[model samples]
Target: MAIDLYALPVTQVSGVKGKKPEELLALGITSVGQLLDYYPFRYEDYTLRDLTQVKDGDKITVQGTIAGVPQVQMYGRTKSRMTCKIVVDSLFITAVWFNRHFLRDKLTAGAEIVLTGKWDQKRLHLTISETEFPGQGKSQTGTLQPVYSITGALTQKWMRQTMKQALLQFGELIPEVLPAELLTRYDLLPRKKAMALLHAPGSLEQGQQARRRMVYEELFLFQLKMQAYRALNHDRADGVAHPVDLPAVRAFVRALPFTLTASQKQVLAEILHDLQQPHCMNRLLQGDVGAGKTVVAASALFAVVKSGYQGALMVPTEILAEQHKRSLDRLFEPYGIQTALLTGSLTDRQRRDLLASLQMGLIDVVVGTHALIQEDVYFRQLGLVVTDEQHRFGVNQRSILRRKGMNPDVLTMTATPIPRTLAITAFGDMDVSTLRELPKGRKPIQTYAVTPAMLERVLGFIRREVSAGRQAYVICPLIEESEKLDVQNAIDVHAQLQFAFPEYRVGLLHGRMTASEKDEIMRQFSSNEVQVLVSTTVIEVGVDVPNSTLMVVYDADRFGLSQLHQLRGRVGRGEHQSYCILIADPKNEVGKERMKAMTDTNDGFEIARRDLELRGPGDFFGTKQSGLPEFRVADMVTDFETMEQARDDAAELVRRPDFWTGASYASLRQFLQRENIFTGDLLD
Candidate 1:
């Protein structure tokens, strides 16, 4: 009997015996299905390389016949090298292999062979990493060759052989999961055909079709899952009917220190509208740093409290929660709305009092970390749930908090700017409102990319700023020493900067510090007690100080463009003209582009676009999202239209029981399960 494709291990397959199983496991290739998902990252067009056009330093592939016996050169007893001469139609090139003396017999005269490696122009030699011969039955020029990510134990030769075997045996059994309508609309190939073409295409064009099919499949299923979530959340019992217009809430908004920007006013209005809806409100509020997201969230929370209901705000870190507590406490105190703080570091008595107040409706609003989702914490009449930094928490975590009450309105906020296309795909289930404009009275920070040669001049500038009654933030890429990465860290930068500014106060902040220690350090920095705060990315959010006027980021190239923008935003809040100095000597072109983007514009959206284009969507979306699935083929920048179509199709499918809730959707269900997406969980 043949084995099942889903459960059959690579060890059970032919040609995959021996230590290949262990090597395969290192690449997450345990089961046949997983092995199939491990498609080649790229392919080498060995079938059509012209030997005449091959240049030095270029990676090329060529097919030729052995013209003579191989030469073995020995250096010492343990070091040996083998060299062979191969000829094409009228051209000849020397191929070299290191430490493979046994290959001499295989290089006999007139042997047809394929070689792929770097071409050394200086010696006109090809340093071959892969070689295939017709006699061995491994070299086939008719098929485009696959190049995959490899480990030392697992080479491309073995991987290709194993994948080929798997496809030949199981490809026929792979079911068609996409509906016929979608297949016709998108011109996609059947699943089995796509697998065959993608794993071992006879031509490059066929491989392209396979790629489109796979990308469509990934984004299609992902959008379906997101649409299902929206449907489930919308179908839930009506949420709290919080009153939006109340005397206290109106008064609080009028009393705000600075006028709300046009973007903020629009988003605030949208939030209030969502709160008035009968169904549960699921919305994502996005903006750049200093875009007044907190104030917008505060306004919504105020409306909830004014209507005599409780509101909860969850942040990524304890320091951020504490800062929100202080900021909101001050904002709502005049409005007579009580606020409480709950975090992991809170004392037993303090937590007890807060929980008790929450249950009794004494605490109108609560700002907390993940502790807000604990089973023990209960809300009196939870009307709204607001989360800062939406990417830090998944939809389930947000739902976990919402489940504590009767379907509370969910408003998630993020300081990072997501591209419009990404916003649709990632936040498809929720209404999105963007705040692109910063609040009034905010000064733009000047950014400049500097090399290490200007370190002295930058330090002198910081000294001048501090002496003029302004504080500075010096950010490092790492907290402590990392053996793998040779980058500046907070501790070393702290010691060096302390010496640089002996007369001024220099404090250090990193992730290794305890909650109280970080809070105290931030407090000192806020009070201008620490003129220079040499910290890691710990101050990425909510370390707002109007007096801080300068930011100096060491190794700025190590950070993403969006992150660099966030770090630059720490300063420039005050009325004075601010400056941001980025000390970076970028090694690669991408790093150079990131530094240039930071110094070019203050627009977060533009930075995000550049970051997406430069790093590709994979790295940009990895940590920037929590529950979103990683795409293997579909790029948001390239497949924007496909993503949009998938979004529409998925939404329609969810409304039909014949597809969404039936056996036809079984494969999609399995895919979502693997992606860790469940609409039932969101219905909670």
Candidate 2:
């Protein structure tokens, strides 16, 4: 039967058809095409070994046949050993398999075997440590062996055979996404041939080149999608031209308790320019935590209100929304612009009153969480919409907020700073404004890495800080005890801390708590009633508590550098000296490097760069697609050059009429259509 690689699911393949392959699905192998694309995690070198080239103490693999029956012998004690003579060309070497009496039975005369072990040149013997049977053929016969990542339920042989069969069956039918001319110009392998070579490459370099071809396709398609999304959204949405309220904005800025840094001033100026434009403002405002993003939002809100249009500030967490609401209300009160809070934690009466005021335009600015996305929530004139922690929200959520008003201006903010190269690749469609400078007099958090033995000292330090009338936070990687992870969890840690520190008030926070419960816990922590708060990474965003000066993160290696930076920023909010203790003993080099990078510098961009280098883009970017498509093969970190090239190529390609109307470009067009990027006039 002929099978189209794109149309045939992996379950239809032989060896997998009758096996209920949920295990393969768990590894993200769902189709014939995907299975072929599932590249090997590693390759084992199987270069042919020459007996004459063997050196003392060198470990190598040598294939040979048993020249004589293996002899069983006992040592001075009860230990049994099997000794055999193997012949390779003119040399006959002694092979010893200790505590392996079965070898005497299996190693029959003239039977071929491949043994890999350390050689004892003085004794002329090869220790038979690893064995390869006849079925495990070419892997030991001087060739590279591909090792794929799989669950215990799936064996390496099964995975390799599955890929080989899939390639043999449907490789020729795999559809190409790129235009022929473009593929030729880049010297990329054809999609069909690339998959074939990737599954069974004659050489290591050939396999890598084939993989690079796939990476280029994935990246190029992504750039094309992003550029199309930009064309559809930005080119069509012409926003109301709100004249810059310079005097009011200046007054709001001057009213801020602390002065704005040069970087903040520059970013705000760029945002203001976007706001007054005839086109919709699709701008990303990224800054590290404590970079005064709240003040910038306040100024933007003031300007929008001064122009007689309401504003909306949506955040990921209810605590953040309420915090922004109170702070904005106080900041804008002197300017006489009313602000209201709309969140899930609000009482029915409170929400009803706020909604009424918002509808009447009495509320010039409304701060909210996902509550703003509800169908009943109406805005009188939402001219400016600012979403905090924008990455936490999906593309559809932002689209829904934009729908509440006619081409409303948007200014999304992220406290997690992303590097410039990555930001351009991810958010190339939007103008970028960055806040890099922190407010003056804010001290840097002293970061340290410690093992389990230092936990008591860290706890003592936290106790001293709490006794001195300051607050602290203990963050756990897990919300609850995970039997599989074996890491410290917030619930168990909180219980242990409460018992250990009986004199102080301790609070617990995690994602499983209800909105009201989280809000109350945050309120207690902010008020200093809960002197030491034990929580999870839910507080990784903008949780401002000046009194909280110390932070201890358990299993810090489990988190990425960007997350570690954000968690550390939770402290050092006040004038008091702050400290961040990482309770970790990383097992690998990557984990240790992450911890070292965390303790080395406090700069978020630097940490982001290091993170991109250490963990690649997927883990660095997380599920926060940031309005960009997730890539399967292309890592923006390693393929930054290719990403840049693809980005340029995509920009040029979209400008051509052929890209939209040519017959060869039909598949590309269909892909963009499915992505909802090339569609037009949705802004209206």
Which candidate has the top score in TM-score?
1
The TM-score, computed over Cα atoms with residue i paired to residue i, of candidate 2 is 0.81
TM per candidate comes to 0.88, 0.81
Please provide the root mean square deviation of candidate 2 (C-alpha atoms, Å). Answer: 5.5
Candidate 1 displacement at residue 615 in angstroms: 2.8
Q: Please, what is the whole-model Cα lDDT of each candidate in the order they appear? A: 0.83, 0.83
Candidate 1 steric clashes = 0
**Residue runs of model 2 more than 4 Å from their true location after superposition:** 1-62, 65-106, 115-140, 143-186, 231-234, 463-469, 477-521, 527-530, 586-591, 624-628, 656-676, 681-684
lDDT of 2 by residue, 1-684 (tens): 544564677876778965437888888878877787788766665555887897898777888888997788887666788888998766899998888786567788888888887789988798877777566554455666678888848887888788887777676778888998888898999988887777677788888888889888988888887777765566453688888889878877887887889998898888888788778887889998899988888888788889889999999988788788888877887877888888887789988898888888889998888889999899888899999988788778888988899888888899878888788887777788898889999898999998878888998899899989999999999988887998899999999999999999999999999988988999999888899999999998888999999999998878888999999999998989999999887575667898899889999999989988887776666765456556656777788899888888888888888878899998889888777665553321
- Worst lDDT run of 10 residues, candidate 1, spans 675-684
